[model samples]
Target chain A: MDFTPQELLIASITRMLRGLNHVAVGASSPIPGAAALAARRLSDGHLRVSVLGSRKNNFFTDGGRELFDCAAQGRIDAFFLGGGQIDGQANINLVGTGGYPRTDVRWPGSFGSAYLYFLVPRVILFREEHTPRVFVPKVDFISAPGVSEPNVYRPGGPYALLTGKALFAFDKARQRFRLETVHPGFSVADVEASTGFEFDRTAHVDVTPAPEPELLALLRGPVRDEVAETYPQFAATVMCGSDDKENRV
Target chain B: MAEHGPIVSLDALAAQVPDGALLAVPPDYSGVAMEATRALIRRGVKRLHLVAVPTSGLQAELLIGAGCVETIEAAAITLGEAGPAPRFSAAVKSGAVHIRDATCPAIHAAFQAAEKGIPFMPLRGIIGTDMLRYRTDWRTIQNPLAEGDDPIVLLPAIQPDIALFHVPLADREGNVWIGRRRELVTMAHAAKRTLVTAETIQEQSLLEDERLAAGVIPALYVSAIAEAERGAWPIGLEGRYEPDAAHIADYVRTARSEDGFRAYLAQHVLAGRRAA
Candidate 1:
C-alpha cells in the first residue's frame, strides 16, 4: 500500500471536500485538480469540478469572468489556495516575505485568492512544503485572512490546511488551527518541529488514512489523465505518468 | 481616425508608449502581450507603472529585470508552477521597484470603476488583515444605511494610461476577437489607450459575424494593432496553444541573475529589433 506524496495529499483533500456540489481548482494546482476529479468520479459526477486554465476540464463557454461570477453566485462550494507562508491565524501570504512593499523574499501577488476566499464556502489552504519557514508565526503579508470582521459579508474562509506532514482544521470561533492528523511516516514531534505556528492537538493523533486500492487505481489511471490536460509537466512527473507525456494536451 | 485602422509594426506599437506611462497589462496565462514587453525593453522605455490587470508572471518579471519598470501594482508576480519570479523578487528585495500590493478583487474592482467612470468601488474582505493596513488608498467607512456595525472597504479606480494584449484575430475594422478572456475588454475600457497584437488579420469584420461578434473588442477602443504571430510567445493564449513550457522554464532558470537576464534580452529582444 505504497502511495506517492501527491496521492496522499489528494486523498486528504478529497475527504475535506465530501459533499461539496461544485469544487473549483485554480491554475498551477495539479494535486487539487486530481483530487477534484477523484471526488467527482466517486460522487458519480454529482460533484462538479472546474479546473481553471484547463481547456478540457473547464466548461465556461462565456469567458474568464465566468469563474468569478460563478463563485459570487454561490454555485462554487469549494476552492483551493496556497501561500509562501501560512500562520496560526490562518493568514496566508502569496505576496512577498519580510515586510510590506519591501521584502527579502518576494512571491507572486494575490490572484483571486482574496476574492474567492470570501465567496467559496470551503476554502482549503494547501501547501506541499511543511516546514517552519512556510508555516510561520506570522505571515509577512496577508493575501487573504482566514477570518474576517463580524460585519464583513463573507460566506467562506479557511476550512482546513493540508500539508506534507499533517492536516490542521481551522476553528473560526477560536481563530486557531487544530492538529487533525499527521500523515503516515510522520510524527507529532516532526510536525511540531517543522511547524512554526502553535496549534492545539489531541493527546492521541490519528495517522492520515491511505487511499483504498480502488481509489488508488482511479488516481493512477483516469484522474491522472484528466489532470495532464492542464498540468502536463506536473502530471508527468508528480503522478508517475512519465510514460504518458505524449498523452498530455 | 488615425488610430482606427493602424496596423503598424510591433516596433511602431511599442514606440507609441513613452516613458513613465501607467501601463495596464493582462495576467499570465491569458492574453499576455509578451512581444510588446520585449519591444518595450528594446526601446528602453523607462519608469513604467506596470499594472498587472489582476496578476502577472514572466511579462512583469522581464520588465522588472530590464529596469524599465519603476512601479508594479498587482496581486502577485510569480512564474506560476515554474516557481518564483527571480527578477521581480530581486528588485523588491533590493528596493529597486515600488510594489503596490492588493488583492485580486481590488485590482478588478478598480478596473471596473474605471470602466464605468466611477471614482471608487466597494468590495468585501480585507478587513482585519494587513492588506487594508498597507494600502493608504483603501479606506474603510461606516455603512450609513446599515443597521449596526457595518463597515466596508472601498478602492479607488485604477485608470491606466495604456492597455496592451495579444489575441487570435483583429479585423481591418480594428475589432479584436478575444474569445472568452473578458478581462481584456475591461482593461481596454478602463485604459486611455489600448494596443493589440494579433496572430491573424481577419478577412471579414469580426463584428459582421454573430458567432465572433460576442468576443470582439470593438475597434473603437483599439488605438493600435500589430500583426505579431505568436505575440504571446512564452506565455499562453486560450484556445490557441499551451504556454511555451520549455521557454518559461528557461526564463525561470536564466532570469535568476542580472547577467543571465541581460543575456536573455540580448538573444530574444535587442537582437530581434527588426520589429518596427
Candidate 2:
C-alpha cells in the first residue's frame, strides 16, 4: 500500500508515540494530534495521550496554577514538539534568527517549549520539512537543549529528533546524533542530500511503516473533527492533504 | 534625566541586580528572562524567584534550572517541560523554594494581599492537600461559628522585590505597553520595583491604541528599562520567533547529567563571566 508524504509522516509519529504509555501534544499541531489518535486506535487504546495548548480545556482554567500539574502528577510519559530550526546536538530554536537586533525571520511558537523539553522525559521533535533552512548545522539561538554541551545545563532539553525526511535518536555516548530510521519513501542518500552537514550513519537505517487502516480512520474521524473546531488553520492545512472520504480497503 | 528611574544598558542593568533578590517573571517569557538570568548569574546573584503559569516552554525550564526563590504554579499543568527532572522535582518538594499549585482566585488573593500591604489572605479552597503542607508560611484560622471543622489556609501576599518583564515595546521613562497580553499587570502592582526589557524603545506616544493604552505599566512602577533585541528568542512572544533548539539541546545535555552540568557552567556561564 502506497502512502503520501503527509500520511507517512503521521504514521511514523504514531509509531513513535505508541511505544510510550502517555504523550502530550501541542496546540495547532496536526501531526501530533493525528499521531496520538492513530496510536490509540491502532494500539487498541493501549496508549494514553494528553493534549496541552495555550487555551485551557475549560474556562475555569487557572492562569499559571495547574501548569504542568498533569506531568508533575505523572499523567504524561512522552511529548511532541515542533521547531523552526534544529541543530546537530538536537537543540531546538523557534525564536528569532541570527544577528540579534534584527532577526532574519520570526515565528509564533508555543510558549512552553523550555518547560516541556526540560520536564518531559522523552520529547519527540517533529518538523514538517527537512531542509538546510530548517535543519541547520547550528541554530542562531538555543530555545531548548538537545544534548548538553560543556556548561550549558539550565533545564528542559530535547530527547528525540524527528524530521520529515528521517528519524534520529541521540547517542549520549558519542556526543553526536545517530540515524535510527528513515521515512518510508526516503533513502539514506535522500536524507543525506537534504541535510547540509554530514551525519553518522554507521548502522543500517530502517524504513518507517505506514499507519494501520484503523489508525488512519481515527485520525480522519473524531480527532480531525475535534482539532478542526479547536484550530481552524491546522484543520485547513490537514484538509488540503487528502479527501475526508473514508478509505475502503 | 526624566523624573522616572534611569534608563540603563543591558550590562548596567545586569550589574545593578543584587544577590538573592526575588524576581517576578512571566510564566511564558523564559527566552527573554534566561538571557537576563544569565547576565545576573554571571554577576554572581543567587536565590532568584519566579512567578509564572505552568506552560511547556523555555521560560519554565529556566526557572527550574536556575533554581528560583519561589515558583508559584499559576496554570493548570506545568506544561513547559515535556517531562520531569528529578533534581528539580526534589527541589520543589524539599522547599528550598516554595512551589504552590493554586487557582487564579488564589493568585489574585495573594497579589491583592501584596497590593493592600497585608501579610496573607484567607481562601476557602486548598484546604486539605499537599499545597497546604508546603506553604507552611500560609497560616490557618478557625472558621467562625463552625465546630469540628478544619480551618482554612491563608496564602501570604507575594510582594516581590522586583517585577521584571520583557515585552514588545517601552518608552524611555519605562512606560511599558504590553500590547495585548496583560500577564505583567499583577507583578507590576505587587512588586516594589518594576524593571522592563523591551525589544524596542519607541516614543511614549506610540501607544495610541485605546485597548493597548489600558494595559500600560506606568513609569511610576517601573524602575529601569533597557532595550534587548531578540530578547525572547528561546522563549516566544505570540507574534515573535520560536525557541533555539540548538541552544536548548546544549543546555539539556549539559544540565541533565551531573558532570555535564558542571562542565557546562564552567565553560559557558562561568568562563564567560570571567571573560566579561
Candidate 3:
C-alpha cells in the first residue's frame, strides 16, 4: 500500500484526537484541517471542526473575538499551531530564527499561537520541515513558550508535536518532549541527524500507522471535499487521486 | 438633512485626527482605509501610536515607511501569502520606531478590555518568553478567583483615540455595513471615535433591511463618513474586490529600500492617483 506522507501524519494526529468535542484549525493549516475533518467524519459528526478561512466551516460572526471567547470559555477542545522554530521545551519561534529585534531570518511574526497555546487544552504543534534549523537547542525569540510555571493560569499547552519525521508527546510536568513514534520509512537516527534540540528518546519507538483503505477512501472523498472548502490548494495538490491509488495496487 | 450628518471628505475626516493620536486600523484582508492612510501621510502626522488590534500588513508597512507612525503595537505584520513585509521588518530591525511585540489574543484582549471599560484583562500564556520580559505594561498576577495560586498575564486595556477602516457601503444616516467583520465594530467600541470610508453611499438607512441592519455599525459610534469608491484598493475591501495583487507586489518590491520607498510614495500616494 502506497500513501502520501501527509496521509500518514493525518492518520497519526486523528488517532491522537479520538473523541475531542471540537477542534479549530486556523490560518494556513491544511494538514491539521484534513485530520480534523477526517476525525469529524470518522466520529459520524460527533466532532465539530472549524476552519478559520472557510466561509462555510467557520461559525464565528464576531471576527477574532468569537474564536478567542470560545477558547477562553473552554468550548474549544483542540487547536493546531506551527512555528518558524520549535525547540525541545515546546517553545515556538514564529518571529524569526535569529535575535528578534534584528534577525538573520524573518518568518511571519507569531499570529495567534501565543494566545491559542494557552487556552486550548490540546495544542498540537505541527511543522512539516524536520531539520536542525527548525528544531533548535534554544529559539532566538520565544513567540510562545511550551510550559508555564505552577502559579500561571494555564489550562492548555503543547500536547504533542508532529513533524515530517516523527511525533513527540510533550510532558508538561517535566517540561520535556518524549519521542513517541517515528514515521514509517524513517528512523530515530534520521530524527537525530536533523534535530538540533535534545529530548527524551525512547528505546522502542512504534512506527506511525499507515492510513488503511477505508481511511484512505474517506480522506480522498468526503474529507478532501470538506478540506477543499478552506484549503483548496492543499486538497487539490495532496489528496491521492483514485487513478494513482488504483495503479499503486 | 441628518443634522450635521456623518458624510465628509477624506481630508476633512483625516484633518480631525489630532497630533500624536493613538489610531486603530483594520487588518490587511478587511476594509483598510488606504485613502485615509494617504491623507494622514500627506498631512505629515507625527508620533502616531498605530495599533493593529492583533495583526496587520501593508498599511502598517506604508505608515511605518512614510514616517507617520512613531510607535507600533501589533502581534505581527506580514504581507500574508505575498511574503514578509519588508518595510515593517526593516523598521523593527533598524529600531526606527518603538515596537511592542505582542501576541494576537493579547491585542484582542486589550481592545476587548477597553471595550468593556476594564482596567486590564487576564490572559493564559507567554509567561516564560522574552517577549513577556520586555513588556513593561504587562504584569503577571496570581489568580485570586481560582482555588490554587495560579499565575495569569494581564494586558492593559487599549483605548485608541480613533478607529479608522474602509467599508463596502454606508448610508446617509451615518451607519455603515460591516457585515461579519465585527472586529471593526470592536475597534469602534474600543476607540473614542470611528471614521469610515465606504465604497458606495446608500440613500436608504442600512437598518431598514433586516439582513443589512444586523451588520450596521450605528451612526452613534461613527464620527465621520466619507464616500470613497475602491477606498481599500491595493488592500481588498473583502467581497467588494480582490486585493490589487500586482500593485501590492510592486509595493513589496519597492518598499525594500529607503530610496525605493520614497519613489513608491511619490509615484502612488503623493501623486494622489487613487485619491477619492
Show the lowest summed lDDT stretch of 10 residues, model 1 chain A.
Answer: A240-249
Off by over 4 Å in 3: A215-229, A232-249, B1-4, B42-44, B144-148, B244-267
Scored against the native two-chain complex, candidate 1 gets a DockQ of 0.64
What digit string (tens of lDDT, one per residue) describes model 2 on residues B1-276? 333345777667776566666666665532245456556656766655555522334454444555544453442223233323333443444455444444444565677679788988765434333234445676768766566554655778988787776777788756787754554766778889877777878765545667667767677787887777766655565456654546655666556655676566566555553221
Residue-level lDDT of model 2, residues A100-165, one tens digit each, is 213344333224554455456677788878888887888765555565433322234455677878
Candidate 1 per-residue lDDT over residues B1-276, each given as its tens digit = 244456888888999898999999888756888888888888899999998878888888888898999999987777777888898888998889998887777888889999999999887667766777888899999877889888888999999999999998998878899887888989999999999999888778889889988988998999989888878888888778678888889988998889998888889888874442
Q: What is the C-alpha lDDT of each candidate?
A: 0.85, 0.59, 0.84
Best by TM-score: 1
Clashes of 2: 78
| Per-residue lDDT of candidate 3, residues A1-249 (tens digit) | 788788888888898778889999975788898898888888898999888766767778888768887988999999999988889999999887666566767666777887788889999999999999899998888888898766666888899999999999999888989999899879999998999998897678888878877778888798898887666657776775665554331
| Best candidate (score: lDDT) | 1
Residue B240's lDDT within candidate 1 is 82
User: Could you give the interface RMSD of each candidate, to one decimal?
Assistant: 1.9, 16.0, 1.9
Q: Which candidate has the top score in DockQ?
A: 1
What is candidate 1's CA lDDT for residue A76? 95
- DockQ for each numbered candidate: 0.64, 0.03, 0.55
Task: Give the share of true interchain contacts found in each model.
Answer: 0.73, 0.01, 0.71
Off by over 4 Å in 1: A61-65, A241-249, B1-4, B273-276
lDDT value, residue A244 of candidate 1: 43
Error of 2 at B185 (Å): 0.5
Instruction: Give the TM-score of each candidate.
Output: 0.94, 0.51, 0.90
